[model samples]
Target: MKKVAFVVAAAMTCVATGAQAVDPHVAVGSAQYSIGISGFVPVICRATVDATVVPTQPGQVSLGSLNEFCNNPNGYEVYADYSPNLGKASLLVDGQKVPLGNAGSTRISKSNRAGIVARSVTLDLPQDVQSGSISFRVVTL
Candidate 1:
């Protein structure tokens, strides 16, 4: 009887150990992971003039015309190439400078593409301004 009882206890221990071997799992329905992913364009513009030299007689003279193209969204400005004697002359678009002739720099137009703005510039010439050549430029604002 002692031998039988010992055998029965050993069998029970083996059964208990085998029961614990079953793996328990918790259900994972869904999983997700995310990452945030993350640039500059330089402001650029071009300007061209129809004439290089403009001759004036002392009253008002029209200096051919100029066309400007700008890639900036806010548009651009045209200015007479800055010089020491630039402000001495007056540039008129309609009747006066868009801003005011400080160094002959004035804001001419504003557009998204600006395409080709053919603007004729008129200068009220002082007899002192002798015959010469002038230049214009476009810049993004």
Candidate 2:
């Protein structure tokens, strides 16, 4: 009878409990942008190229992945975190940019304050962005 009671209790517990799932979690409130670039052209590294941003209202970049999009009332921020395989890398926003000389497999993140209006980005990149899935921007530039 004791064994029967324990089995019953276990079954009951199982019925009362819910299943758990392993879901990818982001922080309380955070967003991200990830891009993949290939086919690097070192010659293009020194030239300034424009990377444009498209507006996504209440949107996040590359959902289900590391990158995300969001719409906040307290002003919006755009970030481009890049990992390039070749050449020098520099990030430009409006007019301010930072240059990184001779880097490999590196991630550099830049934040620019923005609003609902889409804006233009200038880049003096080391290697021309080859090819990769982008969480933000047009992705295919």
Candidate 3:
């Protein structure tokens, strides 16, 4: 009698444990449900400088033009990174003058705008210094 009772109790426990485990595929009910979606856009910018060099002032050298394009909706900014060899350089962007010491970045645009546009970039360097390279950068604002 005791053996039969122990076997019955063990079988009941196994059944209870199996019932406690829930299956992921089991559906609660058939009803309407909602789904979510998302998306993103990356910032893009490009710049090109003309090779044509035209001398303006005594120490100032003006390049042909700088073409820039940015996809940012808010606006964009232009910066001039001068090389270490340059001494006392300044930039003339659309007739606006921005002074930059030997090396570092300086903002050349007075009013930030988006899309493609061409502006004049001139370099005002010391008379002794000649033949130097400067890079331009565009960033979204």
Candidate 4:
């Protein structure tokens, strides 16, 4: 009887341990983005996230809200956009395709074509991301 009660208590405690979404430990240079100079125009940029900060699951990576900060030594205000539609942006660890996630391209960029135009989206990671080395791709729509 005591063992049964202890088992129940342990199970309850495990269930009570709610999960908190943790911010990803980003790789040193995992940056992928596309530049949209005009409506639907695109200039794609792709880079791999640092191997050190691997995703616990596929969804651990993500892109978030863009912000403005001081980047220039001369007091130039630099801007970061989560939306891939803009001219410049950062592709976060979370690069998914929701209302605010990565956009899957119906087509690939053409060699003849120099650009594309579309609304830029942010990056997203899976709720159950995998750990270890991972690859990320950033392209223009």
Give the alpha carbon lDDT tens digit for every residue of 1-141 in model 4.
Answer: 999999997775444332111223222222432222324523334322223342333332333232222222222211222323321222332243333223422221122333222223233443432222222333322
Better of 3 and 4 by TM-score: 3
RMSD of 3: 12.8
Residue-by-residue lDDT tens digits, candidate 2, 1-141? 999999997885454332211222311222332233346432111111232342322212212222222233233333344445313445443445545344432232323321233233444533343433222331111
- Model 3, residue 113: what's the lDDT? 59
lDDT of each: 0.62, 0.34, 0.69, 0.31
Error of 4 at 71 (Å): 28
Q: Which candidate is the best by lDDT?
A: 3
lDDT of 1 at 48: 73
The TM-score values for the models, in the order shown, are 0.53, 0.29, 0.59, 0.19
Question: Which lDDT value does model 2 have at 117?
Answer: 39
Query: What would the per-residue lDDT of candidate 1 be over residues 1-141, giving only the tens digit for each residue?
Result: 999999997896665555445422222223422222222666668877666666657867776666777777776777666444444667676565643345545555666554556777676766776554457777766
| Window of ten residues with lowest summed lDDT in model 2 | 42-51
Worst 10 residues of 3 by lDDT: 26-35
Alpha-carbon runs more than 4 Å astray in model 1: 1-44, 94-104, 112-114, 131-133
The model with the greater lDDT, 1 or 4, is 1
Tens digits of lDDT, candidate 3, 27-65:
332342223345687878876789544443447677768
Say which candidate scores most in TM-score: 3
